[model samples]
Target: MREISLDRLRTLVAIADLGSFAEAARALNLAPPTVSLHIADLEARVGGALLSRSRGRITPTAVGETLVERARRLLVDAQQALDDVQRQVQGLAGRVRVGASTGVIAQLLPQALERLGQRHPGIDVQVAVLTSQETLLQLAAGTLDIGLIALPQLPVKGLDIHPWRRDPVMAFLPARWEPPAVVTPAWLADQPLILNDSSTRLSRLTAEWFASDGQQPTPRIQLNYNDAIKSLVAAGYGATLLPHEASTPLPDARISMHALAPPLWRQLGIVHRAGDSARATAHVLDVLWEQGVE
Candidate 1:
């Protein structure tokens, strides 16, 4: 047997409410013949007479009452589901999955999210800590909605990348060391350094900076977490190179920060799928861009 359509269900519900085929047709903006055909088709499919004429008034039979009750709930649920989708399309409410480096997440993303929450309280941003390379991979794989990645990266197909921020990479030294006002690559290279792991783009950037001065001294240790690197630097383990976001607080009193003599900068970019973005994702992208320099 063919299944009954929502239109027939609606016609039944309307007739049960209005108690006349002509009244239901008028209310539904359907012709009288269409209304009669709908009831006939629905009864044929369900194998039951759905209406009764009693004392010149039309009313539902037992089967019709049960079907109408269930149909009402289904119609209400379907309408609600459409409304939720419309809200997401309007950027009024939805979840956005975003990927970024731990450093950026720690320093930059919080402020951006805070502002986003204020402007769009209904939007929930889900943040993931990922490397620049990992972030690009996630965005390409359709697992992520947005990415904040290190710059100077090779292009990835099917992704759109936009330069977002350029913050000077600074040398973080133990305060007790009495370092120079501006740290040259040679000066930092000669010290015991806590550096990002060789696999990271920042590590490559820092390594290139050192090589420009013909210096490539080995680090005391390599680590991927920036906050952990800072903690080690504070313990007087060694000095390190890291980007210092303008809005972030300076390191603890035990650590001192100085600009690179040659002015090395850690560039960052925003990435997303290369097409029209979902409204919620677009709203998040706007908030992230607001945190960076124009």
Candidate 2:
């Protein structure tokens, strides 16, 4: 079958709406012959007469009405597609896929996303909670546009990871427990601990901090989500180690925050493809950079 031309389809729809070839030609800025040829070409492609002229009035034949209705929908979709592309080209709109841990997403991403929405309301940021290793894999595979990953990662190919934030790891103990002014590994090791899951970088970092002083105490329970761990600590489950942002409000008053003796830091980095990013992605990256600490 012969492929139909959008231009001819447009001409047919215009003629049917105006009920005259001359009016359609005038409306479309085409000559009378060009309008006639468009209808003729369309008829040949479909093997049917598309228009009827009787008693000085023109109207679409049955086939023409069907084609015109469908063409109207097609034209609408085409115009929308063009508009979307144009918005992207103008750097005024796009969708950005972002990956980060549950903690960062809960605590930090909201501030950055709020700034992004104010600055570029047309840009949409879709965030996924992922582990650092999973985030790195997705970034390398070109699935994620931006990544907020834990630092101290082995370099992955085609990815550009830069340190973004460093927060001091603190001990979160139940308020009911008599906590030390500064929590040391020896002090924390003896307490029943509610800790991060073994998969997380924060878990490894805290483990290393404990191991440095030869204290390899086991945790009572391990979890991935920061808020859940904090809730457990508040419930007097056990003491836990977590990074704290100065500006973030503590979820519960029942949990006491204490600094680690040999202060351990939780580091985070942003990752993207090693080249210039799309404008929307750059906008999000700028907001994320603003969230970073020295």
Candidate 3:
């Protein structure tokens, strides 16, 4: 029996995760025919079919499922081994994959990465901007070295979350619209709102706060990008509620921010797999924690 090469194992794992040969090929930067050939060769070596294809969906056979589980562990171990060697020779030279929610990516990660790059020029940082839930999922899957996300009221399983910063939520008002001296939830609800889309954790938390108060502001518009929302408010489209980071330095002279009466705040943090043994990941976490404190 021939041993499975790391490249072939990675191809198999990607196919299983993505559920299609074409997608797996794209991910690995290999032609679709090459992906198919690798899988066929692996199946021959293993003496059984690995995937069952029908209706544009590929399902793993029992043996395929078992192989996938083992392959994932093997791949992680292989990467970790490489990381260990790279650290000794080059001192934090390997790439670190990080995931973060849209808010953190916009407000926090840029400065943090700038400082990290200054300290460790050899380390390469790759970032993925995703929703909070998607960030958590990617972190758990070992695809991301770390995740920056909003702290939900409840904790997630199989992850270690460290509180990094607390940012106050602020109300965005059009430049022409004079906001109340002290904005309350009730007062803010009375205005036409340009709100964050419901897909975000901030939006959900804001919605829950409104639900608790038995008030629902009819949205004049819903948007996901903080910068775009700010631009719209500046254009006199509508007011929005956002974290202080997003509301600060009003791009247009007409826009202003007022603190909420109750002073709502959101906690942001660094999260990672509960017991990641990779030293590079640990170093990157330390760098983030240090930058976050500044």
Measured by TM-score, the strongest candidate is 2
> What is residue 239's positional error in candidate 2, in angstroms?
0.5
Model 1: residue 71 alpha-carbon error in angstroms: 1.3
Worst 10 residues of 3 by lDDT: 245-254
User: In model 2, where is the ten-residue run with the lowest total lDDT?
Assistant: 244-253
- Please state every model's RMSD to the true fold in angstroms: 2.4, 2.0, 15.4
TM-score of 1: 0.89
Clashing residue pairs in candidate 2 (N, C-alpha, C atoms within 3 angstroms): none
* Residue 212 of model 2, lDDT score: 93
In order, what lDDT does every prediction score? 0.91, 0.91, 0.80
TM-score of each: 0.89, 0.92, 0.66
Q: Which ranges in model 1 have alpha carbons more than 4 Å from their true place?
A: 1-3
By TM-score, is 1 or 2 better? 2
Candidate 2 lDDT tens digits, 120-231: 9999999999999999888888899999999888888888989998998899999989977778999999999999999999999999999999999999999999999998
List, residue by residue over 1-294, the lDDT tens digit for candidate 3: 568898888998998889999999999999999999999988999999999997888878999999999999999999999876878355567678899766677777777777777877777778898877888888777788798887763577888988887777778798778776888778778888888888887888788767766788888888778888888888888888888754224456778887876777877878888987766666678777865641
Candidate 3 or 1, higher TM-score: 1
Q: Which whole-number lDDT from 0 to 100 does residue 124 have in model 1?
A: 88
